[model samples]
Target chain A: MASRAAVKTVIMVAAVALAAATGLAGAGARAADADAVRRGEYLFNAAGCLGCHTDEKGGGKPLAGGRALATPFGTFYPPNITPDPEHGIGRWSDADFIRAFREGRAPDGSYLYPAFPYPSYTRMTDRDLLDLKAYLFSREPVAAANRPHDLSMPFSWRFLLAGWQWLYFDTRGPRPDDPAKPPEWNRGRYVVDALGHCGECHTPRTTFGGMEADRYLAGNPKGPNGDKVPNITPQPRFGIGGWTPGDITLLLETGLTPEGDVVGNAMAEVVRNSTSKLTADDRAAVAAYLQSLPPIGPPP
Target chain B: MDSRVVNALAAGSVAAFLYLGFGGLGAAATDGDPAALVKQREQTMKSMGGGLQTIAKFVKGEAGSAADVQAAVAAITEASSKDPAVVFPQGTAIGTADSDAKPELWQNWPKAVEYWNGLKPATAKLTEAANAGDRAQIAQALQGVSKACANCHEDFRQKKQ
Candidate 1:
């Protein structure tokens, strides 16, 4: 091993260089970066962003993409989300970031497919988006090249997404909320129901791409990785309605379920990336908000 | 955790892999060379011993608890069955883990006759424990049996990823 002094010297140099580059960059200065970074990291995993976007678990490098996300239409290669300007999201401006997430548009005004889960992200508030953007910008830029989606013809066309979005997508802002809910609870609801979009997997989907909001999280048998995503709603049978907030919290902190089982799949990646590191309070808030949803069964 | 199921799966998969991937592994112990096959059996026994020893160390003192007993028992039974010829040596009693085999059992092989003589008693002991239905006794017996299995793993088996 290198001497301790050598390691310290390298760390100090890197820290100083980072200070020089991002020291007074005003974007992240609105709030201390640490909180936003923490929240972004949590939401990213909660959103299952890396689970599909990165083939990190099975001997692949983290966030250096190339996982094939299979949809009925075809398989789409989730891009490397590293901060690399050429191939990743490094150069995205705040508006560009918001638009990509909230509007499903790329930096160059191209529309990204809902497969990126922008449908869930669209519910995100401006602050949450900024925080997520802040976290993404703070990361190391990995220079892995991109791969084109192996989509079949017609579905591969970029313009087709525009018409598809018109039918299945909702570009409208999240509904104005009750003032009674505490700010953090509201924030949790926003992230879970919207930007974080836990329901995309937990909730059943319509034959078209839209979610079955009426049923809300009874369970989605068809998950992004093809594993069954169980219900988080208050249904005692097919859902987590039986789980206490602590049960959910433990599940988030560790890959192990309350039943003393740990599964290997998309969820394992999600736990490794996001939820495991979340602050107790944030995870609790998410649990509280989810449990409060109307107790319901999966879509018939 | 349903460690019983996991143990079955682990042992079954290994047996299956050896059977499917290559013919040599699942074949009868008598099929291979006289000396090399004996050495290979010894190696597997040693590795099993080491694995048991490590877990035994963890479960023995402050770290040991009621939770691990069932798992330990299942693991020991699984290992003992897979290679009883090497795992069980001569001169042991029924329902006992090791049954007082020669102290240098690791150093010597008492041949197929001695091997069957040693393992028959241990297997019988395991059968008794299984039938007793006393959870605590079962667990205690398992720990004892597993201690012997660990020694085998340490000496005889190859490490799998």
Candidate 2:
């Protein structure tokens, strides 16, 4: 009887231990998911997702997407990106999310418009894209139907977008690190090129609306809403060459120019939504990357 | 010639003189010429910018004393205290040379007024900070002022073309 009782005690102890171990493993997984969500929130701000997705002027719900983006082609309303299964991306599989950014193809395999800035987002790594998706999914599942784009004729047809994508979209995978450059520079490059998508407005576009890569960051004469985007290259006269890295960081953080004037208009929205939310190190990284660019003179 | 005809000719000459002399002045007085109003507003804005720069210099310890900061804050306060309606009268929207004011300012007049009114508290905080001579508080208060400026400028000011 004593031996049987002792065996029963040993089995009970083993069962309790196994239960605790399983509990700890579950907790660890939850913590990792939480961490990914946090990282994704930061990436969302960096990518300026909220500004385009939320119609603050019209009192639209955040990420529910009724905001109208006026383009030369026509007005494009960004779709709902929240986690609602019916209207948002809640039903999207991980592969679907990755494909949207990587190939600019929807789950239905329809071509996304270039106005989505996928050209820049396509430079994001699969991991970063997934992290962003994780963050987006964590938001409240808002239930708002997406407003359709108001394009005319050929531009409205999704089939034409395939031709547009073929002409302009670079099929290159995530931007690789340069062995020669420091890690900080590479990180800066990622934030500026991949997440910020600054060139989508700052770079001049061709007649067909594809970005002019040769004149990168040279400033667009006719940007969104007919605003003239300024040159951000390191040119002494035309660009930000006179600005120090600290100046750039300060501008990103506060929208205050070195000359003591605060920036206004659309760039102010960028500063408020995106750059201001970046970590101090990331802001400095943006400055470093911008200052290192080859300065291009004004278009002739 | 008859005396009546001579009097009639004299009245006509006087009327022509008055029209030539005060016609432009009368029009300016009533509706505020768009060009002149834009030029005046731009100057006022530039002066405000200069005052902020002086305060910024003090905050950075690059130059200027507390007294300079006080004076700068006072100038900014004085300039910003004016009724925005007078400063931004109708017909002073963008398209006037060097005027960055967007037509939205007039279109959304009440919102613009609210944004302009928002500057009051920011300037007040700046004034208090300047008086206290606390560098940290002054810098923080200055940020509030910048934000106030940006709030209106974001919707009402056009970017450099």
Candidate 3:
């Protein structure tokens, strides 16, 4: 009888220990998920998702898009990215989300417009993209419907985007770290090129709207809102070679130039929303990355 | 009368008439040529920028004295205290080679006035801090002034292309 009692006690102890182990594992998973969301929030700001996704001027809900992006082609109203089942991206699976950034293809197998900036986003690592998705999914979903793009004629034809993508899209996976460079430099490149997507505006575009690969960050004569985006290359005359890393960091922090003048317009918005939100280390990294670039002069 | 004399008189009368019509309008607007007013306002803004630069130098410990900081504060205050309507008159909103003022400044006149008026309080705080000779306060106040400059420029000034 005592042996049977001992066996029952052993079974109860085993069950209790299993329950405890399971509970600990669940807590660990929750903590990891939280960390991912936090990291994703940082990436969201760096990627400038909020500025384009939300219509702050129109008093629309955050991530419930209605922002009008005026381009040479036509006005593009960014769709709602919030997690509402009816209107937003609530029903998107992990593969759907990944494919959206990686292939610039929607869950419905339709090609997304370049106006969504998936070309730059395509360079982001899978882990970073997943983390960003986690953060986005954690947000409060709104029932606001996505607005249709106001493109004219052939531009409105979604199928035609396949041709454009075929011509411009690199279809390459995440950018790999250069073994030759320091970790900081690699981080800077990832942030500036992939997450920040500075080239989308700073780099001049071809007649086909593809970024001119030869003249990266040289400057855009016709940028969004008809503003002439300045060259950020390290050129002494035309670019920011004269600026020290501290000057760049200060500009990112407060929009104040070394000349004591504050930046204005679209850049001002970038300063306020994106760069300002970055950690000091990240800002310094951006400075280092920019300072290291080959100095490209203005187009002759 | 000789044709030469008639031509001279006619030219003189036309010059007088043109001066009276346009000059009266200019006088009614801001008591001087609009271009000259733009130039003056530009100079005032430059002076403010120079003053801020001086303060920045002092903050960085690169150069300048406490007295210099006070002087810079004074200059910024004086420049910012000017009546916006007088300095930023309607005719000066055109984008010329000399003027950086955007047409939106006049389009949203009330908001422009508000931003211009905001500079006064910001500069006044800087003046107070500079007079105190507290470096930290002065730096903080300088941020306020910079923000005020940015607020106005964000909407009114044409960005460098």
Candidate 4:
């Protein structure tokens, strides 16, 4: 009886090993699909596409793109980015989508306004953009009509944006990282400069609505709606130089400042829909990158 | 303008200045000093903000004891219980240097008062949750408190540049 039991146990162990080997191969394929969607979702949130596109104030569908962005140039409405064939990106080939994201050119070859933030999105890697596309394609498509932007006179001419782009836009992706820098810092650089686009709000703009690269992350006095977006540089009095990485992580997670201030402006919306959903590791990366920025004084 | 008459007039002006500057006009000084009132209320608001941060630290499991949560909740409740009408005296609105309070706050005074009044129950719920050490309850109550603040600030508080 003991000999029979030992033989049966050996057979059971062999069968289990065989099943494990077979399952591992299938898991690899499944993991790729799952992983792409996950990464894309992260990019979507980090890029802040939904904040301007979605009509959250009107309880409209996500990415349907009806919210009006008030700018010095005019009020520009974001277009529907859902996968609907007629109304969204459903008809867009991968190349067309890439052109729009990287060059701010639509499938129809019209120049996209800078309000779409392609200047920052242009710095993203092709692989990351593809992953983001995969995630966007997986969403439910809404058939919302794209709204026309309300701009005055010459600003309404989309061709004028080409001149603006010539002055400010850099079509290249981020430069290769310094070999001496840690891999984590490089990763943080990619996330902060490209995907996160923190400088869009933090950096003051030039007279023609271009970023003032000299005072990067120094704060904008003429931010949207005439509100002063505080300087975030490490300046002692005006900037966040005093904030520790943990303090920043907490702010991203819970919208609570180290000084006990609850963010109530556009940042509150960002916290609710974007940064708060990011993983702790991603938040830490953001903190690391922000801390590395050159300390600059507030706008004069 | 005789010498004696001029001397009496100078003495009277000095007496009035001392009366107003010192504790002579006590009730009027307390209500009339808008800068002092604004400063006091701002300090109270800061204390409330600190309390919320402490509670959040506990909720995130970052650090802080249960006692700390209770203490924070107590501070919030104490700060929020003050009457908004008394705290926000007249002449504290827009154009006051360093004052972020908008004139719309005084225009829509009743609704403004309601926003502060709404915090009482929200903080009460927070106190109960903090004492019970229920993280979910505390988070929900915190959201309520945050909403109350946002609702008021959206209309009343001027955004700082």
Worst 10 residues of 2 chain A by lDDT: A244-253
Tell me the TM-score that candidate 1 gets on chain A alone. 0.79
lDDT (tens digit, per residue) of candidate 1 on B66-143: 344334445544544565444443332222332323334444454433443443355446446545545445435433
DockQ scores of the candidates: 0.03, 0.39, 0.33, 0.25
Ranking by DockQ: 2, 3, 4, 1
Worst 10 residues of 3 chain A by lDDT: A253-262
How far is A138's C-alpha from truth in model 2 (Å)? 1.2
Error of 4 at B119 (Å): 5.3
TM-score of chain B of 3: 0.78
- Which residues of candidate 4, in runs, are more than 4 Å off? A1-34, B1-44, B53-68, B81-156
For B35-93, candidate 4 gives per-residue lDDT tens digits of 77777778888889999889877766788987998999999999999889867878888
Give the best candidate by DockQ.
2
For each candidate in the order shown, give its overall lDDT on alpha carbons: 0.62, 0.88, 0.87, 0.82
Name the best candidate (by lDDT).
2
Off by over 4 Å in 2: A1-11, B1-31, B56-67, B132-135
| Model 4: per-residue Cα lDDT over A1-300, one tens digit each | 999999999999989998998899789977987899889998899887788889986798999886788888889888998999989999888888888878888888888988887888888888888889988888999998999999987889988888988899998865588688777678777777888787888789998889998998888887766667778777777798888787788778667777677776677777777887777788888888778878897545
What does the lDDT come to for candidate 3? 0.87
Model 2 over residues A4-50: C-alpha lDDT tens digits? 99999999999999999999999999998899899999999999999
What is the Å distance of residue A111 in model 3 from its true position? 1.1
Note the B-chain TM-score for every model. Answer: 0.35, 0.79, 0.78, 0.79
